[model samples]
Target: MTLDLQQRANRRMRRAVITLGVLVLVLVAALVVIALRGGDAPPKGAPAPQPSTTAPKPTATLPPDDGGYVAPAETVKLPDGATKSGDLPVKFPRTPDGAAAMAVASARNAWSLDPQRIRAGILAYASAQYRDQMAASADAGAKGNREFAGIPATGPVPAGATLNAWPIGVKYAAVDSDTVDVLVLLRVTHAAKTGTQPTTTLIVSPGRAVWEGGDWKGTATDPNQPLPDPVDIGTVGFNEDRWQAIQEGDRL
Candidate 1:
């Protein structure tokens, strides 16, 4: 009957959302590995370096230890009458914090099940030089989304279902006055219906952004640049890694 069909549709939508979230997490993991490894394979005959017993020293760019986590000193500022591109915010200040904010927003949008938001996010957040590449990636993502949902890329979710991703914590390293590398801890969630328990996944994604055209814009991650270690919130490593919790007002 109609009620049975509705339940089946909701279940299908939930499965699609969960599958899409897993795909995003896998993609993020691959990107992080590439960044960490500098995306280079060793020369065919080059001998591998022997492992060192000494512990690796922390990178010099990290904030000075204050016997505890050092909160980011810079604050994000929005432009006058700033608006959003789809559900993603646009027009952040020309500062390090602004770059971090933009990177975080980009990650949230890129991981969402809504393909329209993914496209809009790339257009609004990526740097001019990277837009075409990001657009191609978005297209691929949209195609995958459509395949999983059995609907058009811009189609709405089944009634009573919810799928979304958001940043929960952030860490950043300043590459210079004009560029920054940001790490965002994301929470991806899906619910089949109101009052139902939601399925959640966590991801730590790395991103880079530059100050350009009077606002912060996302750029490809620097293969050679060292990034901070990712840490989950509410863990000891979180404090040791100096991850800062995203404030309520900062959520995109």
Candidate 2:
């Protein structure tokens, strides 16, 4: 009877050892799977990984770090032509394409803020027909301003201030073998001393030129309409001297 009881106890001990060994094998297999998957098994009640909620910031269009003193657009020029009025070309291109380039450049300059440059730019580049019309318009405008201000006809009268314009883009299309239609996008800035703030205006205006009598002469930029849509370039202070330099073709 004693031997039988001892044997029964030994059998029970063996059964318990086998159960523990099987449990340990199952735990080792689970750990191996987690290791192969490149991450530890998460604890119970732990939250799952979540997707990111961040977004990239917008790119800055204007410079000086904080949107002031923005860089101007690149200036386009004729390889064999004078950039400004009365600038003698050392060697002229004599090609129709070259003439078109010069015509476009001159037409854009006609929108200068300075009165003298504006007049000169128009006269130098415009066709005789448009030139006369512009002259008449200028006369009418000056006369109307004088009458409104009650200034004498012969006395000096100040005209309205012109906006500073920088040509940002130019698109040219050949209308004919001798004529080219040019469209210029200008960044026009108006500086206000007593107003809320200064602003930049983006204008895409029309220009047409014909290769006439060995040179290109500009026609009315807008033969069909008066003006194009003006886009606001946001509120910012403009450096006038820099714009003047660009107009003078010194720095673009």
Off by over 4 Å in 2: 1-77, 80-84, 87-100, 139-162, 194-196, 220-252
lDDT of 2 at 93: 48
What TM-score number comes out for model 1? 0.58
Estimate candidate 1's RMSD in Å: 14.5
RMSD of each: 14.5, 33.6
lDDT of 1 by residue, 29-58 (tens): 222222222324521111111101111111
Q: Tell me, by TM-score, which candidate is best.
A: 1
Residue lDDT tens for model 2, 1-252: 133443343333223221110000111111211222222333211111111011101111222244445544333454556444565221224454455456445534433333354445445555655554444333332332222122332344334423344655454567677666554445544432334243443444444556655667654333233323222222222222122112334544
Q: Report the C-alpha displacement of residue 77, candidate 2, in angstroms.
A: 5.2
| lDDT for position 20 in model 2 | 13
- Which residue pairs show backbone clashes in model 1? none
**Per-candidate count of clashing residue pairs (backbone under 3 Å):** 0, 0
* True lDDT of residue 186, candidate 1: 65
